[model samples]
Target chain A: MEKIYTRPSYIREGATSGFCPGCMHSTVHKLVGEVLDELGIVNKTVTVWGVGCCILGAGYTTHDSFGSPHGRACAVASAYKRTNPDEIVYTYQGDGDLASIGIAETIYAANRGENFTVIFINNSTYGMTGGQMAPTTLVGQKATTAPFGRDPKQHGYPVHVCELLATLKAPYYLERVTCLDAPNVLKAKKAIKKAFQNQIDGKGFSLVEIMSNCPTNWGMAPLETLEFMKENTLKEFPLGVYRDKDAE
Target chain B: MEKRFMKGAEAIAEAAVRAGCRFFAGYPITPQNEIPEYFARRMPEVGGVFLQGESEVASINMVNGAAFGGTRSMTSSSSCGISLKAEGVSQAATDHLPIVVCSVMRGGPGVGPITGSQQDYWQATKAHGNGGYKLLVFTPESVQEAVDMTYHAWDYAEKYRNPVMILIDGVIGVMMEPIELPDMVSDEFIAQNKAAKKAAYAPGPREDGRKEKHPINVSDGGPMGRNHADWMKYEGWKENETDVEFYQTDDAELIIAAYGISARIAKSAIGILRSEGYKVGLIRPKRVYPFPTKAFADLCPKKIKGILDVEMSMPPQLAEDVDAATKGAIPMEYCLTSYGVIMNRDDIVAKAKEMLNK
Candidate 1:
């Protein structure tokens, strides 16, 4: 009997994941674990988990991990990787953590070319804080804070982090992917692996922004959230490899 | 030990490196700017890292990260900047991460002034951030003391597995003085320090053959258990870690209580008062968080006529601690300056005389 599918070796056996039902955070966590296992760097990898839904990964993943205060994961990862350059370090951050409260740390860490991977989950809402209007929350999109809809006049605009970071000369790699479907999930995995591999190679500041869905926060069924991602989230966030210095 | 002439801020930076701090992240701020400036030039020479963070908030978080990575780490900032670092400092305290933070304080109720002031005594010794956590705060009174405190700071930090603070006023930060510097820890010692921490917690395989345990820092289980343990640790510090100096205090008529630069000024006043046949003395708390309550409790009520609280903080920050230590049994007088006003030795002497006459 050939075992074709199984849990990644990095994820602990019988560990209970704390993410909500139909949450892509678990999917993304699985991808990170798979990447760590494939690279054989699980033992040497240090994970910095940001506050919000991202912290749930600490339960499911078996790694030397620390939970940083909300939104400061990049700043934390910067020093972690710098001090232990021989080891691998990465941060799992949500849109609220990465784009809103932690934007300065995120931008500065990228600008400094800190050799680490940042796994950014853009779920278009503050999943952990009950769906507030995040910086990545789309205009005309409804959130708890924007009960009617996000108004450009009131909330300004949804920030495109990949585009914002592309302007920086220091970043070695930047890609925006999604876990909307099976095929896209595979692509997302590839991007995440490359981000981690870049750190292994001493490449500076690679980010893989995963455009995901929040079924619980978006107030939709699991299947309806996928449709939401395709119609609204994907249109605002647009999936692609935004910047690759190697390719350039 | 070798004698060296150095500025207070630079001495602190060099001392941390000598104590095996291999990673430093800091922002440019007044009075303490020499710290990061020294590290920027020195860290590279020692095979260490000096990162200028975008903000004070980021700098402290970076120190937190480097500490978690099993490296000796430090960060320095002034009063306003320390306010920004409160969040990261609180987080580091909660996790019991060993790191050093130097607050060379300037005046501030809000960016009040850049000159020397003892305004942050409350912030440093009391609530630096949230959760009502306490750091092992060291209030060094001179360049030599600052260097000595910074040198052994990491030992105390690692010993208790908690963040340690070196709180000096801006006067000590910029003042030049002759100091005896400690020998740098050897590279092997540094490596051993790191290896020990890595084995204990740095995100990977445990040295012993067992599953990776969740770092007590962020574990969700046993909130009551964790809080009780922290409460016990703080209580233990009160018993074992209080550091104070009794200068001419025995059988004195009037005793002055102060810390850091204010203590330096107050000591000179004590000297002046003693020469004039006034039985005045000084009580200096080397570690302010423990507040040296026992020092006050031990004073003979029959011999002590009054105690003067001298500080550069206008509203008398350290006085609260002093008052609690004496339980208002001893009548107290104040000679204070605020908003970056330097305390004068003459003013302290005058206040001591006025209190003794009354």
Candidate 2:
């Protein structure tokens, strides 16, 4: 099988991207856009992008996109998905947007089993502005505000949402994967594909948390940033399918 | 024509089924519980969805959910319940959901009275999901009107892609009236809307894994998307006015504006004034939101000093709308706040004289 792959026809004509030289968000956006395009849902898919670095998703993707209030992507996306159930809707949020401020909306939507896909980019530090503490930032990981590393006494422990959501019955697919390496990026794509497929099949809520790298924010070389996310982030958020209805 | 002598609430539920409403979600509130219960029994027969939500908020959001899966869906509640639903209502209106909501009007800011009152007339028409957006509010005076207005609400909801509210206070909700279900709406109309729902959102394979991707899609990205189109869709609704049911405007001074059961009482009050050799005009608004602002502006009275806006709210919601219509050209007074059943004819006549005399 000579499957020399060319990107889907819907892939935009441009260089890799304007993202930081080795940024993982661009790869993640590409994978998601590719799936949306290949599934023939590019015209129908609506993506609600939350504040922070990912806020530029409306311009990044060709899907019908909406920018939401901070941490309100899930709330707005929930309403958008419910009203236009026919439309393929997804929300792209950073960990701060999904876990900290949007805790109620994210948890309830997953618990209620609202049919939609949520792509959580766990970069461990807020990337749009100067790096700061994020819910997913490692306990001992240092950032601008947390220059001394996230202290358990002052900062809460990192939240493992994929593991947290697995306890609920609503999610059809839940996976925590990373884009720090070639093999891991492929795995993340599979998880995203499954999430979108679950929505298409109406199985239930689905989410794929991608351990993305912010080279510039991490103050590390592109290769080092990838290695740090793999060695550090993946250790806290293990890479695996936390849930699948058929597994049981 | 399913000619059943039905209560106002029951007629509304049946008309929903007739109008292709397959999904209904509601919280149990006084006077409108029949609507939720009726749909509960009837929805299963036709393979529809009926859910009793944990709270009014969840109930409204549930309908919002069902409305997306491409069903002509609805929810019914009273004043308190609708108050709980305002957040979801704003989301629905902004998101432009084609959903029908039946508010069997009751009294209150906080669980005032359950029997019947048009006190919520203003809130139903104007208040927000606390966000200052408005929805279409229809006030039906009789059980027959309740049924037809509810059916038409579903029609207009899909047409406008926003929530449509049918406001009926307790008297109309509980009263049994003979209604001719003239088979006026065909099964084809039902099928057409159902088809629209399906085409809008068609389901594919599931955990079963034997299906293609039934994509969830909505096309809009800033300027190139449907956001502009969605707003343009709302502008057309401005043209379809359903208020101002006028009774004898010719050579009439001292006209009064009222709605729902109050309008019925206002008519009798007008007759009372006429016997005393005074020409009184009655203007009833069937649709309270697209309130007949233009028509009411015409009847500010050549000789009379002002118009009496009648309602059942203490602070009076209609006074504001009346002011908008008259541009404050005429001083407005209120025949206000019937906490339970509508104001009696004599009470309204007395209020009218007090306002007109002043």
Q: Give the whole-model CA lDDT for all candidates, comma-separated.
A: 0.89, 0.75
Candidate 1 structure quality by residue, lDDT tens digits, A123-155: 989998899999998888899999999999888
| Candidate 1 per-residue C-alpha lDDT over B1-358 given as tens digits, one digit per residue, 9 for 90 to 100 | 9899999999999999999999999999898999999999999999999999999999999999888877999999999999999998998878878989999889989987999999999899888899878899999999999999999999999988889999999999999999999999999999999988766655644534325545534444486777778788899999999999999887689999999998998888888899999998899999998778989987777789988999999899999998888888888889999999999999998989998888
Clashes of each: 1, 8
Tens-digit lDDT track of model 2 for B172-291: 888898996634455566667666664544331123321222122234564335556655654555567456688866767677778888787788888888887766787788888777
Q: Best lDDT goes to which candidate?
A: 1
- Model 2, A1-248: lDDT tens per residue? 89677664333445344567887888898789668766867666767777788865444444345455456566555655765667787889998888877666678778878789999998888888778888888999888989999999999899989889888987777888888777877888888888888888888788898988888888889989867866787788888889988587
lDDT for A171 in candidate 2 is: 73
Q: After superposition, how far is residue A16 of candidate 1 from its true place, in Å?
A: 3.1
Each model's TM-score, in the order given? 0.97, 0.74
DockQ of every candidate structure: 0.63, 0.10
Model 1 clashes, total count: 1
Under CAPRI classification, how is model 1 graded? Answer: medium
Docking verdict class for candidate 2? incorrect
Give the clashing residue pairs of candidate 2, or none. A44-B217, A44-B218, A85-B68, A86-B201, A87-B216, A87-B217, A88-B216, A88-B217
